[model samples]
Target: MERPGWAPPGVDITTPTSSRIYDYMLGGSHNFAADRAVAEQAIAAMPHLPAVLRENRRFLGRAVRHLAGEAGIDQFLDLGSGIPTAGNVHEITAGINPEARVVHVDIDPVAVAHSQAILTGHPYAAAVAGDLRRVGDVLAHPVVADLLDLDRPVAVLLVAALHFVPDDATAGAVLADLRDALAPGSHVAVSHASDDGRPPAGLRDAQSIYARADSAVTMRSRETLDAMLRGWELVPPGIVACPAWRPEPDDPPSAHFPGYGLVARLPHPA
Candidate 1:
């Protein structure tokens, strides 16, 4: 697979990437044949994979809106933010408050490139290439530091991203570092794939397919998801399925989605 001129430098276009595969699942065009092939295989195995991805995306929008409107959060750090698609963090928060700042971080060079292109000339939003596990590198990124004030309440979004971490201890430590770095009023919104509602065989197949991608998938139990958000106060309707989290009246039922979402806040100091 020859690299296209549009692809960012240092990216291997031949191998499937989680970010690009996710973009393809969300109906975005930044994916290659390799990514689409893997995504299609997962979809074939689970049939409801597209719906699950859509639900996850919708959860991201709803969570961001809640943070901007109800929680009074004006800045967002979207970690492992995939290819820029509909209802991006900045777009959702900007609707609530135009001046809201967003910093999108991803390990994928292609995702970063596409996001940078999409955010061109937009002063309040920017994208940076960084690993989510490297909490310090992500937070200290020039674009993140310039746009988001760490002293203020910022919403950290890990929507559909942490499942790719593949290591419990590393993921836990990363979350802890991020939690401790923010101000007292900051919020962390997370959505992770879960093995609760799916058949073991199908889930294993899906995981096997994703394992070939640049990042492997690791589905967690609901209890483990809850534990990941330790030290924070969970908002109402805590740690429910994707669509079950603050769903709108017309939102589709979440009967088939095997993902969980929650938004928790670090309490203000006494």
Candidate 2:
């Protein structure tokens, strides 16, 4: 892998990064050779991996547009946001509502640096590097509070990234903290991978490969994922497979994206 000058010191160039692999899966050029190597191995396990990644990205765009346009949401917090690529949250949201505010958060330094480079002049957007498990700090971060009023509705997007959250309790608690802080009308859009349908042995093998990279691929079931949204009101088509989540009228129907996408609105306090 041709290492970039910006990569964190002592970072293992031989190890695959979840975000970088995701970037590669989306047919983006921002990833390195190590990321490509692991991603290619995953593709070998499931030839449709790239297609699934693209479909998920399209779903993210569609979900953001729906919240901004149809739901009148003007603020967003994108968690575990991977390396910036075409049709990112800022690009899609700003295109719809020029005044929309967004905070992009990720544990990946590369992702943060790339986001900063692309969004420097964008008055409505900012990026932060933080652990998603630290829900308190992430929500209390100065930039997030400055750009977004938690007392008002904001869209929190967790797309194609939560699978690394292997511990169910930790994942649920992190989400609950955010839910507790949101005001009435706030929304959360999440997409998580699952082993809902029959899968070959190779896909499981591919998931194992990620364990060597300090990441875990934990695929959940619909019921378990729905449990994560307990306090919020579900939008129509609640917790369906990714490709089926309010897909654009023009998008082809597919039953196997290995992930689920759902948007839920927080109810107002009495």
Best candidate per lDDT, number?
Answer: 1
Model 1 worst lDDT window (10 residues): 195-204
Off by over 4 Å in 1: 197-201
lDDT of 1 by residue, 1-270 (tens): 666778978778889999999889888889999999999999888777887788888898889989999999999999999899877888998899999999999988899999999999998999998999999988887878899999988899998889999999888887799888999999999999888864534777888888999988998999887777778889989988888899988777765667789999998877
Misplaced by over 4 Å in model 2 are 6-11
- Candidate 2 per-residue C-alpha lDDT over 127-223 given as tens digits, one digit per residue, 9 for 90 to 100: 9988888878988999888998987898999897778999999888877988888888999998888887786446687788766665879989989
Residue 142 lDDT (model 1)? 82
State TM-scores per candidate.
Answer: 0.96, 0.95
Candidate 2: Cα lDDT at 174: 73
lDDT of 1 at 141: 79
When summed lDDT is taken over every stretch of 10 residues in candidate 2, the lowest stretch is 197-206
* Candidate 1 local distance difference test against the native: 0.88
